[model samples]
Target: MHPLFADRPAAGRALAGQLAVYAGRDDVVVLALPRGGVPVAFEVARRLGAGLDVFPVRKLGAPGHAELAMGALAGGGTLVRNDQVIYSLGIGEETIAEVVAAERRELARREDAYRLGRDALDVTGRVVLLIDDGMATGATMYAAVDAVRQRGPAQVVVAVPVASEQACRQMRFVADGVLCLRTPSTFFSVGQYYADFSQTTDDEVRELLRRAVTAG
Candidate 1:
């Protein structure tokens, strides 16, 4: 057994195998979380012969504890908060507002940068496969699910190369199906499971999107 995935592309190919049933289906579409998820979804989409698009999501971490996600924001002005975390941490409405505002601006910028004036692909009445590099707390993926749900997809599937067991369980309740290649009991971080988990640059994402569009 290898220590971890060779990289995101390798992980995407692995995921594609598990999702082969959806291959060549017109109603199936792959939605990747920007930055990290694009590369992984690229392979999945290519193998499955499905359309690829980005579903931008921004995590809203606590004011002091940046790693602790209090909620998340997605496109279409949709925001989902973890009320339990908010009440436990005593996060005020004002602080939540501030975080949401900052994330919304960043989300908008990313949408513009990635789409470049093109409209988002329609997910209505489609089988939407949401892909991410991996999930730790899963706040962002949850937000993505919520955003897609609003669009009336026939079904929603959350696919990741690796994720915490707990996060995987939580995601199942939100999505119609969940596909995780690895759920190590001793989960540390998503990057730890990838040999070359480099930071996915904006330019790389833009280039991948370009290739995906051209291939289609």
Candidate 2:
């Protein structure tokens, strides 16, 4: 086990402990970002006895700096971008359009695969907890929050294992509450803080959701 994530399951367990106050509330729902977030959110939803669902968001990568996200897109065409990054990268309107178009398709495909025939949970006047594996630039998670906010959730809480201090501060402006276990000032990529930062497969995500629904 990596020292940072000595016991992998314990990370989720810790998040559950922090979120215990919200347990057994009918007005609360857990929305996990697919792929990596599913497993972490599974533990949280189970512990909270809250309805679990997926909230998909896709990153619009800069043309040359694919890892560097210029912006993000979420359901219902909620787009959030860092104008400084876009301008600095010299990302033109045409490039942004193309990237967003491609990401929208991918987002739709992921949503279809994850949600299947299950109806999306109504966020109207409900406390919506958004979960992801971790936070980097926070652009993607911000996009998710922006998309969910459109449905008029009573509150928005973002829970994650680790995040940059700056990212956490930025998220505070958007989320009602930000629950982060570790916010290191000398932050690097989120994966660096995880001992077992293996790639999460689509099948794994599907199985996690299936199990959550079955357990419910």
Q: Candidate 1 regions off by >4 Å? A: none
Cα RMSD (Å) per model? 1.5, 1.6
What tens-digit string does per-residue lDDT give for candidate 1 at 1-216?
A: 345689999999999999999999999999999889999999999999999999999999998888788999998778889898899999999989989999989998999999888778899999999999999989999999999999999999999999999999999999999999899998877888999989999999999988999999
Off by over 4 Å in 2: 1-3, 6-9
Candidate 2 lDDT score relative to the true structure:
0.87
- Model 1: lDDT equals 0.93
Local accuracy of candidate 2 as per-residue lDDT tens digits, 1-216:
234663335567778899999999999999988777877888899999998888988878888887787889999999998898999978789988888889999999998888777888899999999998888899999999999999999999999988889888899999999998988778867778777878877888788888888988
**Model 2 CA RMSD to the hidden true structure, in angstroms:** 1.6
Provide TM-scores for the models.
Answer: 0.95, 0.95
Best by TM-score: 1
